[model samples]
Target: MAETMTTTQTITVGARRLEVSWAGVTHVGHRRETNQDSFLAEFPLFVVADGMGGHAGGEIASQSTVRRLHDVVDSADVGRSAIEGALERVVKDIAAHPETTDEGTGTTLTGVFIESDDEGSRWVALNIGDSRVYLLRDDHLVQVTTDHSVVQELITAGKLSPEEAEGHPYSNVITRAVGASELTPPDYVTIDVRAGDRFVVCSDGLTKELTDYGIQHFLRQHPTPGAAVDAMLAAALENGGRDNVSLIVVQVGDSSSTEDVHAE
Candidate 1:
């Protein structure tokens, strides 16, 4: 089972009243031998991390980052700057860990922190590696985070087309990652939100099995957050369950207690 939480806040933005609620879900897919991903559901702050490395090392790296982030977000006061600083600290902690000495363990992190403002809430996203965050609203789906993998670089340099990069031998080789590099920095982006906005944070496994068009179509059809998740899981399994897949979908503008957000 899964849970959803909502917090009501009425903010005026240029004579328009915006009511937004934030909700999220995290799931470990069926075929993975171990779960190397984690997420957070605290209001105004949400995150999803997917780890990589040989052996069980990836799991440790991912969990460490998530735990540190939870502690920072939970203990400190909430604000855009505070959240950003916390993220920086988490990245530094990962890079400095002792286990990263051999081959270097690494993880992809995608997180969002929302802050109430006079106009509405501001959404800030921080990302590293290949994990991503997507924003869906007004029937449009936009990828908010760009991957930090080798294939991404080739695409940027005009050496690879989006389709060609998908099957490239070095597609999975990432240029930067938490714990892999001593001086890794995340790419952070900000967006303004209104009442009916929804967000999805997912690992590459999910995207590998489900195309963006497929994802966009599913979201457009599934009205409830839970149903959308179910459909996504089903589609991935149907595609052969190649790797561990995890995802979190959050809706902003509804209000409820924290407990409900983890119910399932």
Candidate 2:
């Protein structure tokens, strides 16, 4: 069985109160015995982690990473430094875990966090592996994160086309990840936020079943975060969910109106 966690939050940034909401869900999929994926959809932080290694190790790696980030969010300080510090700790956490300290134990971390100041707000996206962050604005969709995978590298080198990389045996091989015996800081991108913008942070499990166009179609078909999430999950499952599926839908403001960044 799968579980969905939907949350609607209002965070005050400076003098402006921002209406930000997200809906998240995770499933083990048809082929997996256990769901090694984990996520955090709390205010100011929406992230997804895909654990790698064996069953227990994968779970530990993902949980350790997500739990550590949750601690940072709970600490009332959300920033690049805070996040990077927490992830650095996660490396130690995984290594410290007796059951999952093996070299094969690691997890891909990706997502976006809300950063606000007296001037307004923006989104900071971070990723360590193939998991992705996508943005939809003006009814257009774009992938905001570059995948860190061999297929991606091949595509970049012009040795493979995006279409040919779909099932290239190496499609699942990632270049970097947390708790992989090395400290690789996540790549960060700061995005300007708008009222009607929508963001999706998800594991490759979801992407494996949905193309970018399929994702865009569902997001437009369902307005609210929860509805969009439900639709995407169903479609993914119906389309032969071969791997664990996890996703988060973030909406910046009301659907009926266009808004701008503000601190009040």
User: Top TM-score: which candidate number?
Assistant: 2
lDDT of 2 by residue, 8-31 (tens): 787565455667878998889999
Q: After superposition, how far is residue 91 of candidate 2 from its true place, in Å?
A: 0.6
Q: What TM value does model 2 have?
A: 0.91
Worst 10 residues of 1 by lDDT: 255-264
Tell me the deviation in Å of residue 169 in model 2: 1.4
Candidate 2 Cα lDDT to native = 0.87
lDDT of each: 0.69, 0.87
Off by over 4 Å in 2: 1-5, 12-17, 101-103, 254-264
Model 2, backbone clash pairs (residues 3+ apart or across chains), number: 4
Best by lDDT: 2
